[model samples]
Target: MTHPALIPGIGVEDTPRVFSTNWAVFGIAGVLVLGVVVWGFLAPDSISAAGAASLGWVTDNFGWLFSLLAIATIGFMFVVGYGRTGGIRLGADDESPEFSTVSWIAMLFSAGMGIGLLFWGPAEPLAYFTDVPPGFTAEPGSRDAMLDALAQSILHWGPMAWAFYALVGGAIAYAAYRRGRAPLISAIFRPIFGERTEGWIGAVIDVFAIIVTLFGTGVTLGMGTLQIASGVEVVTGIGPLGNAGLIVIITILTAAFVVSAVSGIKRGIRALSNINMVIAAVIGVFIFIAGPTLFLLNMIPASVSAFFGELWTMLLRNPAQGNDAAAFMASWTNYYWAWWISWTPFVGMFIAKISRGRTLREFVTVVIVVPSIVCIVWFGIMGGTTMLFESQGSGIADAGSPEAILFAVFGALPFGVVLSVLAMISIILFFVTSADSAAIVMGSMSQRGKPEPSTWVTITWGVLLGAAALALLLAGG
Candidate 1:
């Protein structure tokens, strides 16, 4: 294997330059956010409409492509995992006790489940309940409908999905730490191409990974911003802010997170993730107590049965011609799968960073099973409540917007304001955790394996991501 060219000031032994670069990039993005917020206040509808349009186009046209990429990526991970037994190592000193079994599992759950469980838990199941997609047929609001929704949601977030993230991570981690290679995409093909792989092939993979990471992370960031803004609108009746608002929020948030990431993993990312998990657990408990206990209890068995029955079919189902089936795939299955792949680089790097001491089986099982269980329970709690309320004639179903469903359900519950505040806090922390981790990974990749890259490079990616999200929001609007 060819050794990486060591930059004098930025070697494995040096303090990570990526962290510093991330700080500077964040500062710039902050200023841009302020400007966009001002624009949003002046012209909300136009900006929001643009963002919506862009998002629609992407989802409609490229949804299938994202699904295919995810499948391929997942397939690669399985192959690698089967071929190797030891855990994939990352970084210079293998002795670094970065990956504790508890932390490894905690970080994975936090990073992978951010806002997905919180936002989609209720909404997705409800959507599926109303109209059972492929692999099931049931009337909306019926017992069968609720079960179908939970089952489908679990399948979407299950072992298969988590496996994709673990696969990409395992591949990259093995190459970077085990083989003493630079943590770059080109390293993946080194086994096939020999030392010659570093020149063009490596460069292409690095660039491709960067592009995919940005788009994937951008979507998640955008959704996070939207959820927060929507919550704000609900509480204050300030009206919905448009795409410009989303850009401003995302930019500002990105800057803050980049600064946190630059501060290094132990002090920044870890702390944020820890807090995020606590908040999520609290929210889960709150929903369990506030929502219908009997309904949730009944839904689990039904969901489990429906899930197993449809698992294989859902995995292999590809609707080639029908609009309804295509819509189902694009909106739910395809979107979820793509989102998982898009998160691979960020989540993979984060997983690798924290997975230094774990065994392969430990890493795989935690990555795939733990998060899947969390997702399942989360959906059952939140989504179950929404279905219960709707079935009982609470009028939440009339709200119509999937994005608005969480807020609507929360609004109807007792102590709505307090719950909303709690929800908002959790939402903010979730995205912060995601943004901080993504910035760190992107910084590391850009700097070519220097755990922390230059502060400027880190911030540059942060601002660029914020800008791209803004552009997407405008296009979507």
Candidate 2:
């Protein structure tokens, strides 16, 4: 066996400066993406119908699998992190983290769940509060409802979600740094495929990763665009901008992220993520202070407790709970599980890139625990405040759309327009950071895990990502 140190792309000096392209993977993914674009444009209604049906079928039939997979991932991470492998480093034992703890965390939070938290923080809890899921008896506007809502929100965005990312990210990092394999998803399967990992099997795996990343990114970009569009209408006093407007916004943001992606990870991704974290913190603090301060403080712990107390119930929910429970799962929990799984490829790869030199335990702790706490706090504040508003008849729940709920909550506070504007900026920045990271991951995968994929390759992936998002938007979403 070749020693890990002698691998082709093992170190900075030995790494190839060129693209070292995997044309098979790149070409196949490109063709498939192009087909999606053409289908989306030529038959948008059909695309929408097909997408809805596919999502429905998966959520209804395979939701149990999603739920089972999520909990199992969490348990697997715990066992792996604390077991004998806990002390093993992702890189050389003497190596240190490439980025500071704060920066690394900011990137992880940003790429893994930034836009999602921004878009869903207030909306989801309020949603659950308005209509409690089956098997829960909390009154719509009661304190119990508020706690349950927050708990459910945490369930979706917290540990169960991040575990997927940590598992995939840890596997990729181990394969690349410890085993001296290329960083491709295929490389991780080498234990099974052996030498065939370098053949069609490897190309197939990489291509699958690219497609998943592309569409996963498209789903997230779509959310950001919708929220931004809603914000634009709120700030400008303009009417709804329809699908055409969504496409235009998608184009602009896509261009921005493409530029950022080509600027390299250390410079563009890190800087924007750190700055965005600061801005997000400012926004969060402002909301906590300007909203019901005491209620938020009280709800934070209450919600965290509620989440843990009910964690198993939420995790084990399935069709057996009855039709209503199954329906709820299809719409919410199951859907989120599937979304997170779809996203692990890109988010996991990004986490792996910045997470070298950490022990398995350390990596798991940071990736799962830290982000889960962030989500819990974020919901406790944003969702808790929104619930407070609704209970007081502020009508925040009537915000017409989930994307507009945060702005509606802002409208009830001082400096409403100012908050809305800042919220818009934050969403756009999060959108860019996530997209840039996805682009880099796709580029790296296409080039057989080159650490620094060629700039044009990154650009190509970015443009394709935008195209995929645009197609979804044009298909009525």
Candidate 3:
């Protein structure tokens, strides 16, 4: 990377020469994010295909590396949490927590995995039920397969994934708050280049972080759009929406969240997070009560046991071993890991923002333990309902489209349309929470990691996210 230490003092607030808010960083990062969106808009097929190709090659060639990194994440956190460093706070010794424990955990959990769980809670189990991986689980459509489906879903979203996110979050928070540095990726590399983290070298690192944030935010909006659009069609008993319909949904969502971004965190993010969590919990409870209540309750133990029992196989299985296993790993395991990594920059930063004043031990425990519990219960209820629904000949397991599976699960219940509408609204709100936080974080990075960035900057990032989402939808995201 380029080192511009020759042209600057420490790159922080009050230093006119600090590269943290330099025009070069903003100009380069902005152009990169906007350029990708515009290119995808104008030439979506090629851009989308190229992205797929690059990711595909990485999965095929470096499957072991991703798996190693993921497994290592678990070990890394244990070391941090169990060692003496566990007692260290993320912020200064005298600084108290800004939010209560409950509110803090709620916001982080919502941003970390709310939309994902909404999108995947029903779909992944159903998908696994349709086609369990060879040697990893039993035959599809069997009782054993049902157990494996829930187990696999929990594993994918379980502690391993959360640990990966915590690793990044802890690093950023330690660098920014504890060390009194800007919340930039370059700050994390202080051990290697202590003073140069404030130069163009740091700016280059921040630029990559910005691009990752942009992609994660944009693709998240697009995928959430697809799910809700299909959901609305199912609930209203209308035909599938065309591209124009999807565009309208995106536009409205963009506007609502942008308004929320400008409304400030209290009026926007915190409110949405609390409300969405209640709606999601209600939806989960309804599914459990109305559907197979006892079967899902029974799954809680079996799923957790299976995940721990088979953690090694699931962690290490890859395409290099055999054809069937390879294809399965490539699609499911590889997809999940890559998706989570892309989300780390923005999601981890959000986690960091809300995670100040907590010890490393407390933060790691909450991040890994709470989300893992939520996901297992979520999959157990949602996935177990799918199995019960399928037993009655609903064909929910064969829905083919993942986005449609949640609505299909709700279709079996009495007042199915009403249930589906609840799901749709909850999902939109969950997505809005993510978009709003990402916009604020992106603006924060562009402006020297201010806790609250300018409204105009936040709106600019939100609008850019909308455009990217629309373009990516066109590009087959």
Candidate 4:
């Protein structure tokens, strides 16, 4: 194992002391995360309401900041990839990729934003289309309405989101692998901090990263557990899965993540990712063949074109212009940007962890392009199929909740029940993969970026994450 002092490429005098400093961070962060979880359990409503109010204030006041940073992040990815620095390497001059390109992409894509698409891809477009964004949305059930809705989904889930992640991942990878620093976000500030990178300031940065990772992972787990519980109710004809049922679901799924996390990334994360891709492909294929195949095919180009065509308008539209715009930004665009930003340090480092030995250009291109294109296609097919239902008044857009939208679409297909079960399985696996990957990132950061953190640390994070999710669900979020 590389010592923290030796991990710093320069100024290595006190390795042991530096390791102690990092453990101090680890202890503080763990305690803080547990504290928040306990607080949520004791005062669920107050915590949830307070957190929501804080988020609302930021989204309302700093809407421009989020929009500006998003566009700037995208531009940075493009410039860094094709500029003079295009040929820069992430590691040693002659180093090669740690995993095959396919496996690497699968792992990152799943970790980055896979399971959310199971719901949002179908739900968001339809939701926006039905209510419309007020100022720009088309007439309900019109052809233009279809275009507008698909375009909105494409934009929200497209290249821009991935670009934020690509830049963060690129910076971390270059800093850690090339500069020979621990794979912590703090390491990226080494130029400024130098020896101070091993001190309190650096510890603060890592602590913030860990807290964000823990809370973000908790949110994912909570949302995913609720969705899984709902899907179970759908497939098994089970009762409405009250609070008790949801807790049971969280416990079982959390156990799954703990096991996968402890199994080690090469086996657990990778295998689950392969299965996720296969199951996702199964659903997509089944929908394309069984649904409005031709219209869905046509939607691919139409949605892509419309997304780019309306890019500037969507980017610059002031959310405060009208009630609809305000609600849309608050509920959709603002929330999306916030979640993406919070997850960046976690997902970025996870990407960087598996991205050693790839060139800067290769790294950026794959990070920005592949997931973006995959998102477009997934939304196109899934959203397009749902539109066929909505255009004829299928009521899917007005369904129980966003998480239930995909299952609603499946109900109309042959062997719908079986496919829905597979989907629920896919959701479980995706969350498992994500939580375990996040646990690895948190564990690695806490351990001074050890390539392989101890299994005990990994398991602890996995279980704590599950407990945090249980807390959130109990809190009525």
Candidate 5:
């Protein structure tokens, strides 16, 4: 292993420290996350209400800040990746990447946005088609609605979103690999905080990282479980899975992630991420070939073009448009921006860990550009096929719920059951890969940025994440 090159005067030791856990951060963050879970268990109503109130207050007041930060972060990534520092390697000058280029991209793609793309691939576009955004005058279900729907959907899952990940991930990678700092969120601030980073200031920064990561992963965990339940209903002809069933699903998948995490990154995360990517590609190809082949092929480039064309309008949209526009922003754009920001700690740290030995330009390009392209193509095929069906008066836009939309689209295709089953498998594997990396990241954080945290610490975080997901579902989040 290449030793981390510690920057002098930052207070990090020249030699790596061996410790079971960094008690301050571990105990504090763990207690807080557990506290929320306990509160949810005991008073689901109150906790959910409090959470909703908090979210509303933040979005209503700071929504503009979120939007500004998103656009600015995108610009920042470009400048850093292409500026004077662009060619700087994240680690020792001569060090090559620990993982191959293919594996690197697969792991980052899987951990960063894999599950989300699958969940919203069809639902988001169909949503905008049925109910167009305020700025657009397109009639719902019209050809214009089809173009605007895709543009808006791509905006949400596109470059700006990944920029948040790149900003945090790139900064951390630079600090840890390039400067030889400990890989903690707070450690990145040594230039600002100096030795204070070793005190309560650093502790606070790390605590926030841990909490945000837990909740970010928890939200996805909840969404993935609901979708998996929907898949179960579609494939096995079972009825809706109530909270109890969701908990069961969480329990089984939580075990899978915890085990994978314990096996280490190279053996478990990389292998599973690669396999999941292949499965995802197969599903995308099947949709393109089996659904609306020519339409999907046509929409791919059109969607890419539409995304750029619609980018400025969507980003500039704020509360000024009207109450309807403000409501829309709060409900969608602002909410999504907040979700991506909150996820920075988790996704950012995981990417930084895997990104050592890459130049800043390479890091930024892959982290931002490649994933953005994949997202555009993905939504085009999944959403395009669904829109084609809807335009033909298939009533898929009125499908009872978003979770069921993907399955409904599949139901229209040949061998719908087989497609649904494959989707479920992809989702489960995504669940494992995301949660697995998150557990390891949390473990590393609590252990003061140890590259490989202890197995017990990893397991503790994994189990807690599962419990948190169950609590959120029980609370109707």
Candidate 6:
């Protein structure tokens, strides 16, 4: 029955009021902007150079280590589910009308999917189709090519990937709800160290998780925002907004997300999630029915078969020769694993918060299966359509990147202008939801299990993320 520590002199209920102070939030925002400006002027080259160096180090030394660690973490969840006391149960007794099955599903999908689906769905399949990774290949635009693309994308977003998040989420949820512990990464070590996780060790873990999450999720937010900006450029035929446009977009979006987050999970996160899901479904349906429907239908079975046939080999394959396979592994697989790991802290925490009332089995199924399925379908429809179009020799070149593929696919559709507009809007909302969720997680981390961090802390993280993204963008330049 331990409750969140209250601010001195403030009633427990009044904590939210203190936490929501506009002045503090704005001040933090100012610091964030100032940091970004300083970085822009003084260390522009260092930003991208550092990112490249860091990425190189991870790929060269720690790529396999991350994969193995991720696998081990997943294994731990099954042990916990089977051996732990009380097994897994649904819903907390204290909360009013805990997240319903539907709401839970929506929140998970929105938070997990982000804008990656919109950007990667079409391009990744096409990448696999053309180059094919080390373990699998098919003639460009051939039936096999299309299937291979879908299969690989699914494999990337499949059980193992979702399991990574589920393990972390399960660990956090178990510690917080089952053990009456705080929601922090240190809780994962409680089984090993007991109360020793409470002092400096816990603080270090919390801080590490916060910093990693900030950078990782910030990279994602930047990527999503860039996509939105690109989508805007595509639809409106506007000149590049350069770095200034990126800052403006981030500022406006951050404000919207903060408000949604402050409104609490029910009214804000839930509502926005449902709306985003509906929009996503509508977009998927449009692609399925209007784009190469028959081709897409045929591709699924073939892809599933190919994926199964190559699953093990693909997972284990690491090309020693410096060729397409190596590039694919480095660019796609390695980068994705890092991104997922980076995202675990924020997404895992958010998932744990909403997953309070579910069994271990239910949590695993929903968190891993539902979102993975959504990713597969999304890639199938969008990616499948891109292959169909490219095969027909429609003068549509392979979109060098995932972001490019989204614009290409949407541009080819009937009422292309309208659909692209709506898609852009949806991307903005999706980015906000993601940024807000990360902000909340970072806020919680800063406060060390305080349900919500001070407004200043939340805003500070938001601005820093935005600044980091700007640095990455400048580094690319």
**lDDT per model vs. reference:** 0.70, 0.89, 0.80, 0.82, 0.88, 0.71
Model 2 earns a TM-score of 0.96
Runs off by more than 4 Å, candidate 6: 1-41, 70-87, 90-97, 321-323, 398-401
For 346-439, candidate 5 gives per-residue lDDT tens digits of 8999999899888889999999999888888899999999998988988886667778888999999998899999899999999999999999
lDDT digits (tens) for residues 315-418 of candidate 1: 66565646777778867787787678778877887787777545555666677767777777788888889888888888886767666788899887888877
Error of 5 at 47 (Å): 1.1
lDDT of 4 by residue, 70-186 (tens): 999989888888887778778766777888888898898789987788868788878867776655657877777778888888778888888878887888887777666677888
List runs of model 2 lying over 4 Å from the truth: 1-19
* Best prediction by lDDT: 2
Worst 10 residues of 6 by lDDT: 4-13
> Which runs of model 5 end up more than 4 angstroms from their true locations?
1-20
Clashing pairs in 3: 11-18, 319-326
Ranking by lDDT: 2, 5, 4, 3, 6, 1
* All candidates: TM-score: 0.83, 0.96, 0.94, 0.94, 0.96, 0.87
lDDT score, candidate 1, position 58: 74
Superposed Cα deviation of residue 444, candidate 3 (Å): 1.1
Q: How many clashes (backbone N, Cα, C below 3 Å) per candidate?
A: 35, 0, 2, 0, 1, 2
Question: TM-score-based ranking, best first?
Answer: 5, 2, 4, 3, 6, 1
- How far residue 48's Cα lies from its native spot in candidate 6, in Å, is 1.2
Q: What lDDT, from 0 to 1, does candidate 5 have?
A: 0.88
Clashing pairs in 2: none
Kindly give the stretch of ten consecutive residues in candidate 5 with the minimal lDDT sum. Answer: 3-12
* Candidate 6 C-alpha lDDT tens digits along 1-477: 533221111212322322232333234434554655467558877766766787887787876776676567656655655454223453343333278888888888677766777767777887777766676556666777677778878877766677778888877876676556677887789878878776667666776677677677666777777787777788879987777888788778877887876766778888988888888888889878878788778776677677788777667766474566666777778777788888888888989888876776677667876776677767778878887887777534554546666887777888777778878877877887887787777777666566666776666666666666666565563
lDDT of 3 by residue, 17-104 (tens): 3423456666898888789888988898999899889978988897777778888888889889878778777776555777777778
Which 10 residues in a row give candidate 2 its minimum summed lDDT?
5-14
Q: 2 or 3, which is superior by TM-score? A: 2
Candidate 4 wrong stretches, greater than 4 Å: 1-21
Candidate 4's TM-score reads: 0.94
